[model samples]
Target: MSDNSRLLRRLFDERVRDLGLTAAQARLLLSLDHFPDQNQCFHADRLEIEPITLTRIADRMEEAGWLERRSDPADRRARILHLTGKSRDIVDKLQSTVEHLFEDTLRGLSATERDTLGKLLDRIGENLARAREQEPVHG
Candidate 1:
């Protein structure tokens, strides 16, 4: 699964190369699209990356006019990420690129196979989530 993920990511990177985004950046942008107005800490957790790392990536995206960080109303210390007009404009293109990539990747699979794969992946995700929830708390 890890090998397949890496290969898919590589293919996605190649497809989006002309759009001037790395797979990480594209992932960040897409994640924000799905779950908006989240703080850096939240995004870092969702992306499974260090807060400092997300900060650095956000810094670049901010400079590029793709997104902005605003002080959260509930917590001034926390900065919520928001997509900019520039990013919103290109989001469709990004999504379409992803769809195309998936189409290519799953080209050989039958519809039933695709449905089964999706369900299995969802089950795995749910199992992982349950495992995380059951982990012992540490100080």
Candidate 2:
């Protein structure tokens, strides 16, 4: 892994460890928690992960009382992920850490610079997604 990636991963993991969750657990909850006006409806297939892996992660979170899974109203076969009350509480706390981290990580950047950095990161994610979609699956 790149030095910056490894550094950020450890920084994030250490900051949120008190929530009694792993890095992956925090990610799943944070993703769902981020859906403010989107009805908390996320298509599991939209994530870059394999469908089976996503399903397993969702199942694990559900078992951990972090979330609940239900069939999507529009798509009976597709599962919709929702944060449970327990998770909602933790998510609020987690969001605080996320927000603080954002501010701290960019402490050296001005507002405009922070905005530019965010835009660049978004573009990188877009490029990565496009690349993944074009890649062939290997067994």
Candidate 3:
């Protein structure tokens, strides 16, 4: 837990909350933006989240109009999640603010330093992801 990104996320969450979106709703929306090309089906196995937990989260998002769960066209009965217009603008604003905050935070860093930090951060994130993948999911 040496990672300090939680503070950044908290700030982002506050901003989103002010705009009428819960943190989870905002994240679900951003996740959609992350895979703009992919249709509703997110590979639950690849996300390293427990299927049950992800299902609940997705269900909540769907309930809030942030997204909808529908049968995958290629595999009917397999639920695929998709974002709706309800969350689109709020998500866009959150993303823009995140980008601006990132740029502002790294404003003083030289290009080489930024590159190095990016590489290091990516490595650290991969390590964390791997660790999380190994942890048993508890209901």
For 63-99, candidate 3 gives per-residue lDDT tens digits of: 8777877666777667767778887787788898778
Model 1 poorest 10 in a row by lDDT = 15-24
| lDDT scores of the candidates, listed in order | 0.91, 0.75, 0.74
Model 2 worst lDDT run, 10 consecutive residues = 36-45
Worst 10 residues of 3 by lDDT: 37-46
Regions more than 4 Å wrong, model 2: 36-47, 122-139
What are the per-residue Cα lDDT tens digits for candidate 2 across 91-114?
888889889887877898998998
* Residue pairs whose backbone atoms clash in candidate 1: none
**CA lDDT for candidate 2:** 0.75
**Per-candidate RMSD, Å:** 1.8, 3.7, 4.2
* Best candidate (score: lDDT): 1
Q: Write the per-residue lDDT of candidate 1 for residues 15-94, one digit (tens) a residue.
A: 78778888778889998999998899998999899999999999999999999999999999999999998998677789
